[model samples]
Target: MTMNALTASAAALFFNHDGEVLIVNPTYKDHWNLPGGAVDIEQGENPYDAAVREVREELGITPPIGRLLVHAWLTVPGRGAQVLYVFDGGVLDHDTQAAITLQASELSEYRFCPPHGMEDGLIPPHLAGVWQQALIAHAEDRITYVPVRL
Candidate 1:
């Protein structure tokens, strides 16, 4: 057994001027997600770099990423354990927001959602719960740890 066998992912939390968090609608999933993806360890990318890469690829903007906001772990049915990292992307300005260009093939749309009750159930509970906690941690100026159970 190799000690390095693990799956990891990185995500970012970007807020608009109205304090709404940015969420993306992936064409492959019914739920909206943060601008992030699995860490390309094979390509020598760390969690932080992966988050940056994902943001650039998915949103076509290169906003500066900040410290870690949320760290979580989830049990995958068949893929073993997965570690997830969420970074504080800070607030996007009008010019940065205007530069967003979604990857047409991967993402269908994007929106800035209120941190409270997400309108129309667009976000799943697992994500919503974690997101809410992340918001709380941000407000308190600290990092948050979340455990996801299936």
Candidate 2:
């Protein structure tokens, strides 16, 4: 890939039955984002495997993977350009589970919250308004299953 070509990455938006958003507070950054990470090209890794692995690693819950919701260009300051691939995650038996806690080294917290609870004031400045937009896109039926790029 060219230097300017943003590396592709995958993320899981693990939504509860009530539609609550699962946000991960990461150890690497002050801002919380969905569970996901870079695609390990060295292992010949693809985006779907990376997404599932990230969710399992961060939350310790591995639900049946679901559809694609949104795809966009996400750039973390100083982390370089990244093409973000977000998928809709499905869960079962919500009440039986304990809240997923952040892994100490890479995560600080994880929680299910009202979609509106994610806002400018509380959200990381870089990702401030994204959750709302994602919800809006979902409500408007703009979010749909996207085939992973080959």
Candidate 3:
């Protein structure tokens, strides 16, 4: 029997009082992404821990991470399969918002983007849909699953 390798990544959905989602521009990639990164499965890191760790590493904050919002199955032609988790980072209060410091090497900038502006903020454009679903799942106090191909 043959086994296929699958990787996973975790992200968080942070919002402001104005209902804008937080997004970051990565220095290593052209597209803007949420404040999370690949799950270090090799190092025994789970998705949840990875989310928390990534947020701290990327944004320099340790805000309480809430429940899972979305679980997405993604298939990339060359990269194989990946599972993505989006967790509710909750709304950032003024104090937390003011403390954000982007990782100089990993991120170029971070911004709060309103829902209508996500299409322009996210790369591939379709990612905006996943983020929107995450917002809906958060608001409804539920979880969602989405399939994506890249």
Cα RMSD (Å) between model 2 and the true structure?
A: 4.9
Deviation in angstroms for 51 in model 2?
0.9
The C-alpha RMSD in Å for every predicted model, in order, reads: 2.8, 4.9, 2.7
What lDDT does the true structure give each of the candidates?
0.87, 0.67, 0.89
What TM-score does each of the candidates earn? 0.91, 0.75, 0.92
Candidate maximizing lDDT: 3
Model 2 C-alpha lDDT per residue in residues 41-117, reported as the tens digit of each score: 77988888889888778777777777666766655454456666677675435552474645677888777777777
lDDT for 143 (candidate 1): 94
Ranked candidates, highest lDDT first: 3, 1, 2
Candidate 1 vs candidate 2, lDDT winner = 1
